[model samples]
Target: MKILLIDNASLTPVNSALCCEPKTGEFAKELQALGNEVTMYGQIVESENIHAFNIQENGINVVGHHRRKLKIFNYILLYLLIIPQIFKSDFIYIFYPSAFKYISILCFIFNKPYGLYVRGEMGLKNGVSSFIYKKAYKVFTVTDYFTTLINSLSKSNIAETIRPMINLNEKDIMPVNKKNISGIFKVLFLARLEEDKGVKEILYAIYKLKKMDYNLKLILVGDGGYKKEAMHIIDKLDISDFVELKGAIYDIDKVKNMYLDSNVYILPTYHEGFPRTLYEAMIFGTPIITTFVGGIPYLMRDKFNCVQIKVKSVESIVNALIYSINNHEKMLDYAKNAQTTVKPIINSTRLSHAEALHNAIHNI
Candidate 1:
C-alpha cells in the first residue's frame, strides 16, 4: 500500500522536540517496514513560500512548505500545493485538522479514500470541525470521550479510539529499585505552564502542603504563554523556594531522567485528549497523580496504577501527596503497576508497530 500522511496546519517549525511529529513518523516507518510506500508532507509557517526537505531519517519521505502566514490567501496557496501530492497517493492519512475539507472534496471529486486522526479536543470549536467530521471516511481520536463526541456530532459510525503510542524499550526501562526512597520526595508537573494545565492549582497545593510543614520539592517543566502568571502566583504564595519552573525540556533523555529521578508525577490538566506525558511518566515507573478529566481515567485507576485527583482543589492534591508519601510501599506498587500497564501497549519495536497498524487497518 502507498500511504501519504498529511500534517498541513500543525507542522510548525516551532515544534523543536517534534513531539507530535514522532507518532506520525513512527506510523510511516511501520508502514514502510510492512513493504509499503509512505510519504509525509509537513507545512511550516514562514515569511515567504519556500520548499524544503525534512529528511525522513527512518524509511519515509518528508516534504515541508514554508508559508508567510496562515491567512486565507496562504491557506489557498497551501491547498493548491498539497492537493496534487495528496491525490498522488493510494491512501491519505491526515493528522490534526487539515484544509482537507477543500482537498478532501477535491479527492472525492476524483473518488479517493482518506482517514483523519483527531488528536485534539473535538467540539470545542464550532461549525468548521463538525463539517470535517462528517466528511472523513475514518475518524481516529485519542480518547473514547472524543470518539463519542465526534460520533454524535458527525452522526458517523466510523470513529475509532487509538491511544497515543510511544517508543518503549527494555533498555529504556531502568532497574526497579524498591528499596530506594526519596528523603524529600520530588513531585514533577510536566506540562505547559498554562491556566488550562492547572499550574496555579499545582502551586497552591504545594503551598498548602508547605503550610502543613511538608518538605517536598516540586519541579515544573515546559514553557508556555502563562509563565508570568504562574510565576506571580508562586511569588504571591511565597512558595518559590519549594517550586522551581525548569522551562521547556526538549531532550527526551533529559525528560526520562526527570521521570526516573522523581518520586511522583502530577498533571492537573483541566482538559486533555490523552497526554503523552502521563504515559511517559508511567513507563518510567513513577507514580502519577492526575485529575479525572478526559481519558485519564482510562489509563489510571485510583490507588491501583495512579492516584486520581479532582480538578482545581488544592486540598485534594495535598492530601493525595501526603497519602503517597506515607504509603511509600503502595506508591511504589502503583508505580510498578503503571509501568506494567503501559509497557505492553507502547513497546518500541517494528513488530509491535506492525501489529498496531494491522489492527487499525483491519478494524477500519
Candidate 2:
C-alpha cells in the first residue's frame, strides 16, 4: 500500500534525519516498515531552505519545505508538490488538525479514502470541516474525550481511539529514585511554554510556594509561542530565582534524566489528546501533579497515580504541590502505582499504527 501522510507541525532536516517531533517522523518510518511506500509532507521552521528538494531522510522519503516570510506561498507550493502523491497514495493519513481543513477537500474531490488522526482539542472551524469528517473513510483520535468531541462535530459516532505514541519500554529505563535527593523538592514541567498549557498558573503556584519559603525549583522545558507571556508572568511574580526555562531539549536521554531527577512531573495542560509526557513521567516513577482535562482524567485518577487539580486554579496547583511535598511517602506510592499501571496499559506503539493502516487499507 502507498500512503501519503500529512502533518501541520514543521520538522527540521538535521544531518540525514528529521529533527524534533519524533512522533511524526518516527510514524512515517513505521509506515514504511510496514512495507508501504510513504511520502510525508510538512513545513520547515528554519530560516534557510537547506533541503528544499525532496530528500530521503531516515530511510523514508520526506519532502519538507522551508516556509519563507510569505507563509501562503509556502502552503501553495506544498500543496502543488504533494498533490501528485496524494493522487497516487492508496490511503491518506492526516495528522495535526490544521491540514485536515484544506487537504480533506482534495481527498473528497478525488474520491480518495483518507483518515484523520486527531491528537488534541480542535474546533470544526466551519461546516466544510464537519462535512469532510463525516465523509472520512476512518477517524482516529487520541482519547475517548476527543472521540466524543469529534463525534459530536461530525454528528456521527464513527471515531475510534488508538494510542499510537507509546515511547517508553520498562526494561530499558531505570526508574529514578527521587528519595536519593532529599530536602529540596524539584518539579518538572515538560511541554510547550504556552499559556493555555497552564504555564501562567504553574508560575503563580511557584511564586506562592517560594513566598511560603518552600525550598524548591521548577524546570520548565520545551519552547513555544507563549514564551514571552510566560517570561512576563515569571518576571511580574518575581519567581525568576526559583524557575529555570531549559527551552527545547531534543536529547531523549537528557529528558529522561530530568524526569528521573525531578521529584514530581507537572503538566497542568488545558487541552490534550493524551500527551506522552504523562506516560514518560509514570515510567520514570516521577510523582505527577497534573490537571483533569482532555483525555487526562481517563488515563489517571486523583490521588491514585497523580494529584489531579482544576485547570487555571493556582490554589489547586499549589495545594497539589504541597500535598506531594508534605506527603513524600504517599507520593512515592502514587509514582509506583503509576509506573506499574501505566506499563500494562500503554501497549500501543508505532507498530499499532502500522497494523491499523494496513488493516484499513486491506479492508477497503
Q: Report lDDT (CA) for all predictions.
A: 0.72, 0.77
Which lDDT tens digits does candidate 1 get at residues 9-32?
444353342213455556667778
- The numbered model that scores best in TM-score is 2
TM-score of each: 0.74, 0.84
Per lDDT, the best of the predicted structures is 2
Residue-wise C-alpha lDDT for candidate 2, range 1-364, written one tens digit per residue:
7788887667666665555366666677777777888877777675222222223646776666677677777777777777787888888888747753578778888888888887766663457667877889888877777777678988887787765465556564455445654667899999877778999899999999999999999999888878888888889998889999898775678988898889899988887778888888887788898987767888798888889898889999999999988888888888888877776556533346656666667666
Model 1 TM-score (2 dp): 0.74
Candidate 2 segments exceeding 4 Å error: 13-20, 47-55, 66-82, 124-130, 148-158, 170-181, 232-236, 348-351
| lDDT at residue 233 of model 2 (Cα atoms) | 86
